[model samples]
Target: MSENSINSARRAALGKFGLGLATIAATGTGNLASAETTPTSPHPVVLDRFDHIVLTVADVERTCEFYVRAIGVKVETFGSGRKALVFGRQKFNLHQLGREIVPHAHRPTPGSVDLCIIASTTVDDVIKHLKAVNVVITEGPVQRTGAMGPIRSVYFRDPDENLIEISNYL
Candidate 1:
């Protein structure tokens, strides 16, 4: 057979397979033949927003304290005394050094992550708060592109050396 015919056959098979998988996911049944019964415009699974993020830290207590004081989040304990920093509806869960849970980041080293946190207040106010807490600003009051759009941000670090950007949407 020619290469073009082989490619066309492969594409047809893959398209059928994808539709079958989508059906199985929607109905929680593993019947590939049932795909035809599913709606033509099946709703795709979409995530709304983040609820929490885990930060692997060298010292959980120290990291928690830094966020509480500098970023103005409150600490909460849950599920066998795990510490989390809570702000609005989101949180940062702490995983202590040498005690990381299974299925974590490939390189769960301290200071490895660079996270940009959204600030409700202006960047200037964020700067003032940082100075008041004696947290050193590494850079910015600079413009950067955020996930939602344009933002103004300032950069700093936590006790674990994780680069943090506090940003306000512009």
Candidate 2:
């Protein structure tokens, strides 16, 4: 077959295989190795295998929408009877804002509620995504020690002004 025919056949094969143009081109050029089936990580170290993280929000539906629409997290369940909103990797419980729990005087203080979510993505990406969604970030993607080890973290608040931390290891 002519070179054009060979190239066209390869292109069709790659398209059917769901490979990107870059991956197809690299394979065609023979510069990429077969061993490199997937992209390589710089560290390649395994992070924590956490099952879930939970947060308390004032409005479960609003909080659930924020996560699903903005943060790209899929909602697993909406509360039936005071249960939390369970998303892809996290769960959030909606604590009703009332006169007893959230007294008129206690509405202005810090430490009322706080939560942090750790992800595989970088700290910068998390900050950018949150900022895009108008989520006010208060702290850094700074490195810190946790139960697992060191991690990169940023702090922010939900609609209820509850402190939240989003983190991943550097």
Top lDDT: which candidate number?
1
What local distance difference test score does each model get? 0.78, 0.55
All models, RMSD in angstroms: 11.3, 16.0
Q: Check candidate 1 and list the clashing pairs.
A: none
- List model 2 lDDT by residue over 49-81, tens digit each: 234433445566787677665457655644354
Position 13, candidate 2: lDDT: 49
Give lDDT for model 2. Answer: 0.55
Assess candidate 1 and give its TM-score to the true structure.
0.73
Q: lDDT at 167 for candidate 1?
A: 92
Consecutive 10-residue window with the lowest summed lDDT within model 1: 39-48
Candidate 2 Cα errors over 4 Å, as ranges: 1-56, 78-83, 98-111
Superposition error at 163 for model 1 (Å): 0.9
